[model samples]
Target: MKNKSIQIQEKHHKELQKLSESLGQSYGGLVEKMILYFKRTGIDPDDLKNESPTYKIQQLDKRLVSFLKVQERAILKPLRQETYEYYENHNKTLKEAKSLINKKIVQADQNSKIRTNNILKEIDKQREALNSICEHLDPANKKGLKTVFQNIFKNAN
Candidate 1:
């Protein structure tokens, strides 16, 4: 291995010596370990005391969760409300259409019943006339039957 030398402040060197004693490592060994740790993790050693990678990651995670919540409130809540309203409107329209159809069906049924009643009344009137003519014919009066048929034809006109 090659030897290299670098100068540092006296106070910083003493602090490093204290840390090396606590960690049971020589000063040079501690410095080597620190350099390896910073290089491998891409962490800035000067900013370690102010903000660590763990703290930054936690902050980012919290920001992500808060952003998701904001997006939900801003985007999804109104969409859900609009969808519900649209559904209700369609449902109401369908109900109204169904009601109209039912009313039309009922009116058609009533009209059919009235027309059927009128036809039946006409049929009953014709049946009474036929019965009356048949009664006159029972006596075997041909002239009387002919006179009754002529009167019936005149009344119809």
Candidate 2:
């Protein structure tokens, strides 16, 4: 048989040469290996060599379907149910946590308002007591009123 040569671009030829060198094989050896691999896999090398874009897309789709079917039969079964339950529990927990936080916030706000009101009432009572003492003081008993005021402040401290 007469040997024929396939012409390739310089860049592609250099790439092939580099690949062959890296694999420790000659160009002819690489070609032979590829032919053997295609034969063993029952794939026609000519079909791949002249593959159209549409044909390649169809082949890819077939591969994807097969891959998905395998996954559906194996990994997806356990994960699908677990994923649903996880999200259900997660949403329920989140709602409960939000309700608890809201209740705590409302309670804290009510407590703050109650404390403020109590402080205002106490201040009013103190002002009324001071006014009463001032009104009850006798004009001739200034020293006695001053002593009483001092005793009140001392008791308070």
Candidate 3:
């Protein structure tokens, strides 16, 4: 295709150059990129010409515009609908997964609490058994046994 050139102000030219640099592109390349971007975004850059007060309606090929309109609708309509549907389903699935995870977390926490309570009860039983054994010992033997039992209980606690 043949390319055309347009004149821009020096300030705009400098700005374009900076933009091109930031985008890792050349000035001409940047213009081409912008054209493609506008096309993809469904914005006709030519339509902006109407902003000028003195602008005249150029001869537009009606058949070409109609064809483009039909093609655009054919291509974009279903895609837009499908995109919305996809997001709707995706969000629903995400919420379901989060709910499942939360349920599992609550169950795990309850299990952990039950296990901790059982462990504490077992330790109390052991302490009671030690006290009963100390009570049945002779006075001389009780002193040394009581000290050992106290050390064990302190360490366990």
Candidate 4:
């Protein structure tokens, strides 16, 4: 390594020496690392030291961007996934409920039709039985039965 000396204030030199010792590095290495860090990050040490508004705004912007990215990853992504899953499950449940209701309605319609047909058949049998009874009755008995039926109906009304 080429050894060279650069003039600096005594206080600055002493501070640099202390930093180098604490970090267990040579003065040249420490200074080179500091320069590289500043260059890589596109930071101006003078801007930081001067506390410029523009520099403060830039730092704030970086922090805000970082916070947004973290929120997106840690909160937004999972919440969105859970919501989508719930939406899908709710839709599926609705479909199942609709299908079940439709099946039940169809079954009820079929049962009602069967019951109606059976009731019609029973009415027809009762009409036939009444006609046979009328045919078997003598003229006098028929007259008496008709009078009794009329009186019963009149009382009901």
Model 1 Cα lDDT, one tens digit per residue, 1-157: 8768879999999999899999999888899999998899887767747577798899999999999999999999999999999999999999999999999999999999999999889977986777687666755655576557658766875
Candidate 4 overall lDDT versus native: 0.84
Over the stretch 1-157, how does candidate 4's per-residue lDDT look in tens digits? 8888789999999999999999999999999898897888777787736565588899999999999999999999999999999999999999999999999999999999999999888866875666557556844564676556546546754
Best by TM-score: 1
Number of clashes recorded per candidate: 0, 0, 0, 0
Best by the lDDT measure: 1
Worst lDDT run of 10 residues, candidate 4, spans 145-154
TM-score of each candidate structure, all chains considered together: 0.65, 0.44, 0.50, 0.50
Query: Which regions of candidate 3 are displaced past 4 Å?
Result: 1-60, 138-141
TM-score of candidate 3 against the unseen true structure: 0.50
What C-alpha lDDT does candidate 3 achieve relative to the native structure? 0.82
Worst 10 residues of 1 by lDDT: 138-147
lDDT of candidate 2 over 2-102, digit per residue (tens): 66688989997898899899999988788779779777867675574867558878999999999999999789987998999999999999999999999
**Per-residue lDDT of candidate 3, residues 1-157 (tens digit):** 7777899999999999899989999888899888897778665656855433223222345666887889889988888999999999999999999999999999999999999999999989988888778867845664688778878889877
Flag the better candidate by lDDT, 2 or 4: 4
RMSD of each: 6.7, 13.2, 20.4, 9.9
